[model samples]
Target: MKVIAYGASTSSTSINKALATYAANLIPGADVTVLDINDYPVPMFSEDKEKEIGQAEAAKAFLDAIATADALVISFAEHNGHYPAAYKNLFDWSTRIDQKVFKDIPAVYLATSPGPGGAQSVLAAAKGSAPFFGGNVKATVSVASFYDNFDLEKGQPTNSAVADEIKAAVAKLNA
Candidate 1:
């Protein structure tokens, strides 16, 4: 199986990125490719920008990546209760090219934050929008108060309950 995973954030040391990597590692015997949203930077989406720049290579590349995935692992990093700028901008660019950006692939969506909300608002937003983008959001994992729950040395959640929840959610995609 081909698992394409990415943290929907651009920060160099993003906790969302760390979560995505850890989740991908749990999918037994699969080829995994982790993507950085920053790699697909396109100008802010706009009719004017579209007319000026024409077709965007980054946008097409993003779509092509999703098209090749047997399953997807995306962990959202919330910024002000929404997707970070890099991810949102890439998403906007891809949607202009094709509204069904995920091309009907099954997906595991996750979110994490230093606070108790666990980036739940963003996860809810992603769940709400996934169908429109052709993403089969099979399962979701949310880790709240990340600093307290996650261990940087172990590269996973320190709390067993939180860790188990993530494992269970990842299992749903494998199915």
Candidate 2:
């Protein structure tokens, strides 16, 4: 499968990005493309900006990237219990290009944080609203206390149960 995966943040060293990349690699024999939202930067979306820039090339590029995916794995980064500003901005622009941003692609949504809450608030929001944007959400995983559960050197979850959960979630795309 051709999997398009990304963390929903622009941070240079995003834990969510690392998590997303790790999870995407778990799908056996899958070709994974890990994207950085920074590569598709766009001005913050607004009616006025839309009028000024009609259709953003970056937004179109973002959608085009999704079009190439057989499956998607997105790890959301929560900032103050919500989507990160940079991701939300690019997503808003992409929506303008097509409200169905995911184009019905089967997806696994994940979230991670250093704290115990696991960024579940944003994960819930993403899961709750995915269908509205045509995301075929197959599973969702939230990794809590990221530093404790994840092994940076190994680039995978140190907690065996969490690793299993993520593996199970990604496996659904093939199903």
Candidate 3:
């Protein structure tokens, strides 16, 4: 299966990116493509911008990535308990290209934070909104205190429970 993974943040050191990449790697026989939202940066989505520039090449690339994926793994970084601006911009542009941005693909939605909440609010919002965009949410994970639960030096999950949960989620998608 082909899996597309991304973090909904532009931060260079995004914990969400780390978590998403780890989760994607867990899927057996899965060919994963990990995307950095920063690379697909487009002018903030405004009706005016759309009218003047039409679809940005970056947005087209993002949509193309989603279109080729069999499954998706997204780890959202919440900004004030909501979607980050970078991610929201990408979502807006992608939807303009394809109303159903997710294209009915199975997905594993995830979130992570240095604090205790672990981006649960954004994760919840994604779970609720995904189906409307043609996504099938197979599993979700919220990793709290990401620095404590993950080993940055090793680039792996240090929390066994969280690792098991991620493995189970991957299995569900693979099934």
Q: Which one is best on TM-score?
A: 2
lDDT (C-alpha) at residue 134 in model 3:
86
How many residue pairs collide in each prediction? 0, 0, 0
How does candidate 3 fare on TM-score? 0.97
lDDT tens per residue, model 1, 1-175: 8999999988998899899989888899889999988888898888899999986889999999888899899999999999998789889889989999988888899999999999999999999999998889989988999999998778888899988988898888867
Residue 9, candidate 2: C-alpha displacement in angstroms: 0.7
Instruction: Report lDDT (CA) for all predictions.
Output: 0.90, 0.95, 0.90
lDDT of 3 by residue, 80-171 (tens): 99999888988999888887888888899999999999899999999998877887899999999999999877778899998998889877
Clashing pairs in 3: none
TM-score of 2: 0.99
Which should have the higher lDDT, number 1 or number 2?
Answer: 2
Instruction: Give per-residue CA lDDT, model 2, range 78-143, as digits (tens).
Output: 999999998999999999889999999999999999999999999999999998999899999999
| Candidate 3 residue runs with Cα over 4 Å from true position | none
Supply candidate 1's per-residue lDDT for 9: 89
**TM-score for each candidate, following the candidate numbering:** 0.97, 0.99, 0.97
